[model samples]
Target: MRVLVTGAQGQVGYELLQRVPDGFAVFGYGSQDLDISNADQVRAVFKAVKPELVINAAAYTAVDKAESDAERAYAVNSDGVGLLAAAAENLGIPLLHISTDYVFSGDGDKPYTPEDVTHPTGVYGLSKLAGEKQLSEQCSRHLVLRTSWVFGAHGNNFVKTMLRLGSDRDTLSIVADQHGGPTSAGSIAETLWALASVFRRDGRLGWGVYHYSGAPACSWYDFAKEIFTQAADLGLLEKSPNVNAITTAEYPTPAKRPMWSVLDCEKLVDAHGLVPKNWVQELQTVLRQLGERQSV
Candidate 1:
């Protein structure tokens, strides 16, 4: 099957391009190649590619920046997604889009399900939620995978930031109050491919919004400790830095981060027979890749 993927240079998008299974033809476009927010660009690309499936990995992901740049964020996250959804709808194909855990208010103590009432706290979350709504409304066949704390070898993320800091400093401070799954971009790409494969075989999916993230949710502080431990073990760092646990109040940002971003992924497992991978194992793989890159 021929597939079109947007945001080809992004973490998950890069992984999707690399891990295309046998018997599938994939075309990937970065922002310079195809601007999904532009209706003409969207129409032209869809007309040219005529893909059997469309996976939207493009998003305005500057969480804190979104506060000052809501218009751009909505253009990419909200309007871009709507355009892709409309294109897919026109072609009568499936559009699989990625979303975030920030759509919630982050006040709850329990893990979030897809059915939970959404109350985004900031511009970023509000914009993403708008995108989700656009996809649902515009496309008949679509899947929205709401994930969190995505990191991978290919892009800027918390893991890479931690690794950079760990190597440079003797100590580092991380927020302990906020918690969520540290999902790997590779894992997310794999999940999207699995869903694509199922659609290829069955011609339909248990379509709708579903929560899929890494196993064993953790705080930023816990995530940093793991990163340091794993980096030291891999010889990526001379030594693990002293990770200082700090509360969210200690470190403020323009965008309010969700204090609790844990997602319950049982719905996805039940529907698709897929399970979230252990983030520690995923992190090890990522660090190994980074280690290889450093040597080169």
Candidate 2:
């Protein structure tokens, strides 16, 4: 089976490129390789590649910048996805598209299920929601996998930011009000590749909206504390610095995040029988890959 992946340089896409699944031929494409929003370009690529499966990791992920660049965000996140869905539908193949937890309003006390009502507070989330709608309307065989707080060794992410700051400074301030899982791109890539393998073997899999994130829910402050704690334990940090927890009010940004974007994985569990993995373990691997020493 041949798979076409978009946003090849991104956190998730890079993982897919680095560790492709067994018994499959994969072609990874970045924005330069294929402009998803361009209908002609999308059609041409799909025709040439003739892939059995398409995984769309391409997205305009600048959460705050989306507030100012709404047009660009929608172009890539919404319209771009629509083009991919159309091409996939035309090819009569499955399309696995990535989404985000920001689609939810984030005010819920409990975890969000796949069937929960969506009310995005920011342009980024709203645009992603638009992309999800495009898939539902355009493609018959599709998987909209919504993930949260994604971090990886290959790209810029919260974990890398913390590592850089913590290594040089004695203190870091992070927001405590928001809560969600800090999922690793490695985990997402692993699961997607597994799904691709199964789908290739069976030629079909029950497809729809699914949520997969890390095991435990935590605030940015909690995530940072964990990063520093694990980094120190792994001898990756020069010093155990202070992690000052503050409310969202203390940290102002262009985008307003969901206070509780935690997603319930029960539906995904019932569908795929895959369980969430802990991020701390993944973090250790990422830090080590980044040249951090393992504690003796």
Choose the strongest candidate by TM-score: 1
Total clashes, candidate 2? 0
lDDT of 1 at 124: 97
Clashes of each: 0, 0
Question: Alpha-carbon error at 184 in model 1, in Å?
Answer: 0.4
Question: For all the candidates, what are their Cα RMSDs to the real structure?
Answer: 0.6, 2.0
lDDT of 2 at 14: 94
Q: Return the lDDT, model 2, position 9.
A: 91
- In model 2, residue pairs whose N, Cα or C atoms come closer than 3 Å (at least 3 residues apart or on different chains), thus clashing, are none
Off by over 4 Å in 1: none
TM-score result, candidate 2: 0.96
Model 1, span 1-296: residue lDDT tens: 99999999999999999999986899999999899999999999999999999999999999999999999999999999999999999989999999999999999999999999999999999999999999999999999999999999999999999888888899898999999999999999999999999999998899999999998999999999999999999999999999889999999999999999999999999998899999999999999999999999
Off by over 4 Å in 2: 292-296
Pick out the ten consecutive residues of candidate 1 with the lowest summed lDDT: 159-168
Error of 1 at 47 (Å): 0.9
Q: What is each predicted model's overall lDDT from 0 to 1?
A: 0.95, 0.90
Collision count of model 1: 0
lDDT per residue for candidate 2 within 157-265, as digits (tens), equals: 9988998898788877899999999999999998888778879888888799999999789899988988888878877887778988899999999999899989998
